[model samples]
Target chain A: MRTDAAPSLAAPWRKRRTTHYRRAEAITGVLMASPWIIGFLVFVVGPMIYSLYLSMTRWDLFTPPRWIGLENYQQLLFNDPTFFQSLKITTIYAFVGVPLQVALGLVLATLLNQKIRFLSFFRSVYYLPSVIGGISVAIMFRWIFGTQFGLINSALRVIGIEGPSWLGDPNWVIVSFILMSLWGSGSSMLINLGALQNIPTELYEAADVDGAGTLAKFFRITIPMMTPVIFFNMVIGIIHALQEFVLPFVMTGGGPADASLFLVLYLYRNAFQFFQMGYASAIAWLLFFYILVLTLLIVRSSRAWVYYEGAIRGR
Target chain B: MTTLPANRSFNQSSGQLKQFLIYAVLITGAVVVAIPFAWTLSTSLKTPQQVFTFPPVWIPDPIAWWNYPEALSSQPFGRWFLNSLVIVLVSTFGTVASCSMVAFAFARLRWPGRDLCFLILLGTMMLPDQVTIIPTFILFRELGWVNTFLPLIVPAFFARNAFYVFLLRQFFMTIPLEMDDAARLDGASHFQVYLHIILPMSKPALAVAALMFAQFKWNEFLGPLIFLNRSELYTVALGLRTFVGQEYGTDWHLMMAANIVFMIPLILIFFFAQKYFIQGVVISGVKG
Candidate 1:
């Protein structure tokens, strides 16, 4: 798409541009793309290179970086229980939250996929939280789940049940975070809705002719058909869940015994809070490695479960 | 038509019952989803004492319209709102113009290394921001962009968002190549072709990119939180958090009021441009 890709073999008859014309076009392309080229250098490549060095060193922003090969990784893996605890929370957040979020999205999308009315209205309502800032939503969640005067507690009182502290209680903080994760599940819901809409109506009609019931049709048809979309959402959800910072940071401050500290928050703390720049870089690398490993595992196993339309297996 | 017997009629009635059941379930779920926003609105109008009543005050006896002003004036919210607006507009413009320009370069122009560079640019999307954020902050600090809007806004001009570049590039490809050739046959150069031809035709794609970037910048937390530390320089997101601490200990009414105010722009933008937002999400989903 960029160049016709086989321009090197273009016949002389079709060649409208002379060498001068070609050189001029190249200059124009570089001139037009200069900003991105400069940004890719200053902002991206340079930083990544520096972080690679910083990852293996001990450097506070005030002092120069000192080389200490793999020491930060060694300590982060072995000596730091807080590191492990944060990783535990992060894993729980990624695994548990991703499944439930994907399930909720699938359910909502399926329901909305029915021949019901006012679908766009319902979709907008569901996706409202996702568009709002994490800070504001975090604030709203705190109020909704407040210990005494929250709506949840107030509703619970009507049913003769006492609502536990949502953000405050360590036991329920991550659960609270999961519920919050669902508010933004609308994006995936809409994505799933698009996929649902794309499923051929003929398939469902065929299922009906076969006397397949609704549940049977859903399991045998809809779910399998939705696997690609679901898998995409799952990988995305995993990455996002692992990196969740604002909600836990703003709501719980990773408190009530560091129960809600995510990988990014801990990294942010080490970098900015504690000024352990080198250690933070190391943490960042670990997270990067962790994501790569996890995604590779999913891609490796996707063959068994993931169903792609027109996709042939084993090449 | 022949009239059905009782068993067939029973099946027909059951079908009606099933429709009723689906509606019932959907409505219940809708209400559950909508309550948080409703409660926020209700709380914003409620009196301080009315906010936390055991029965949960559905409506305040007297609406405290003053809460809005009270919350707004409690801090430099007006300033923050302006700052956010300026930042969003400038950055959104920068992103669209620069991204579309680069997208033009990648999609239309045949330059050396075009495909190769594009692949590298697309690869940038996978590079985690966690790694890049620290060094960028340090770079900005050295440049004296710390505690200013420069660090937040400067990158937009550089068109650093690979997603948008990819999006516009994909969009530009959908356009017929003959359009460019026809424009070139005239006296127009590539820039003119981009300016007079591609852009006007690419409004839908450009609009989606702009709207999504606006929403993203409006809600953007981390960058603003890091770069703009001065109280007067705070964006609304940071301002709201700071207000939480500034008005500590059971000031839920004012807090809700502030939140509702903060949320108005987002809700309004979403309400008006629902199509673009949904399209953006769907586009990203499909691409991924």
Candidate 2:
């Protein structure tokens, strides 16, 4: 991927000409990167600063923002019960949903990794729902999880068992979200499959030579080899879990006493529905801070578990 | 390398059992994943009465295909479809054009501050959209760009998504630099090399980016929900939301019909360009 040959435009005087050529390349690089650089400033950095300011104040769209000096944050942290409820719901959803997605995704990937006929067909079927947008899936699942005539209840009734209202019951609302999360485990499954395929056969052969059984070979070889990919999935999946919005919004509307009210859902309500832009900004920042802290914790924990093939020296 | 005949036979029997078990689990998983689509399709064709029928009609008795026209006509879905098409196509074009260019810079060109800039871009990916939504909305509102598609479309032109840029950059890095050397020897400028050589040769990666952008824009709910207030300007996703949010009695059959209609384009794209979708997911996952 490296370019070693100097273009003809570079003169024979190696010192001065090399400097000139380097400058030209640098200018081109900056020109090429300018779009993203400018975009990062305007879209990401600028709004981030303004949001920090907005988080400190109380403002509706019509009036000028009144500076509240951390009142929004203080109120949210110490005074608001709904804020704590939203946090509790979102925390449970993310912590539970992420691990479930990772584990189920790995299981599905392992099943698919077996040498089989119609491999692509099976993979496609599993991965299909993930490509579909969140809104449509949420709507479809709303019907599937409905109280009286939903698919699950109807099926449960045939087996002479009763089923609880999935979306309508507060106790079962998070369970419904977890089930939905499992349905879209395709991305992690694909990643795990790719990692599984890339594991060298020699490792398994060595394990076979040692009279290692399937379970032993799996734990000693396959899992250790797959830790890097697993770590990647966990981090990405946790962030995604924390940011869930559309599904709860479309399916349950955070109903059954706000049991499914994810952090982002609460933020949306504050910003748009309630027109509490400043307080909404505070919630957004809190969510951002939470995600950052969680990501750092995962990265720190990965050092103990995640293995790098190239970097490892010995058992 | 030789094994006893009895040992080989024993291994073969065990392998057969393992294969059967794998098939069992895979089939169960496939069926579980697929049932929702099957149910949605069946419900789309069912009458209101059959939708709630106990013992669950897997197939609608009368096959009420009229639900499609009925649901679609009840809303200005035609207008919404057109609106969605405009937003998706233009935004996809912007994403491909800008992200590819930015990716080319990051992947191929040498510059001071380049690594720092790329790191900053990666950091932005970790920042949730909620952090910026309020201020970005206010920015657009102040520009009087509310109730318009500009808020959604213009950001793509600026290469707003770092993930796309990273994906394109990863793909770009795999292209051998000898090709660029030949173009450079021919007196091609950096832009010329990007335009004439890289873009033409990297069709698959570009297709991945464009398809991803199109899918994302078509199904986008939050942006459209916030910005576009007029029903006439509603994207298909927003239109479907309105259909489901009607105040009167919920019409399950028609709502399912509309959802199936909304999903048609995505399904078609999946059937035709399935490999790109899978490849994109694999690539995005591998390095991250």
Top candidate on TM-score is 2
Off by over 4 Å in 2: A1-17, A313-315, B1-8, B245-248
Best by DockQ: 2
User: Where is model 1 more than 4 Å wrong at Cα?
Assistant: A1-23, A313-315, B1-11, B245-250
Query: How high is each candidate's TM-score?
Result: 0.94, 0.95
DockQ of 1: 0.50
How much does each candidate deviate at the interface, measured as C-alpha RMSD after superposition?
5.1, 4.9
Model 1: per-residue Cα lDDT over B119-186, one tens digit each: 88866866667878888888899899998899889999998887898888878877877787788888
In order, the Cα lDDT scores of the candidates are 0.84, 0.87
Q: What is the lDDT of residue B5 in candidate 1?
A: 28
Query: What would the DockQ be for model 2?
Result: 0.57
Error (Å) of candidate 1 at residue B177 is: 1.3
lDDT per residue for candidate 1 within A1-315, as digits (tens), equals 112243233435338778987787788888777778888998899998888788899999999889999999999999999999999988998899898889988888888988789988899988887888888888888889887888888899899999888877888998899888877788889899988988999999998777676678788999999988888899878977788888887888897799998889999999998999999999988998898889878877887898987565522
Looking at candidate 2, what is the lDDT of residue B96?
94
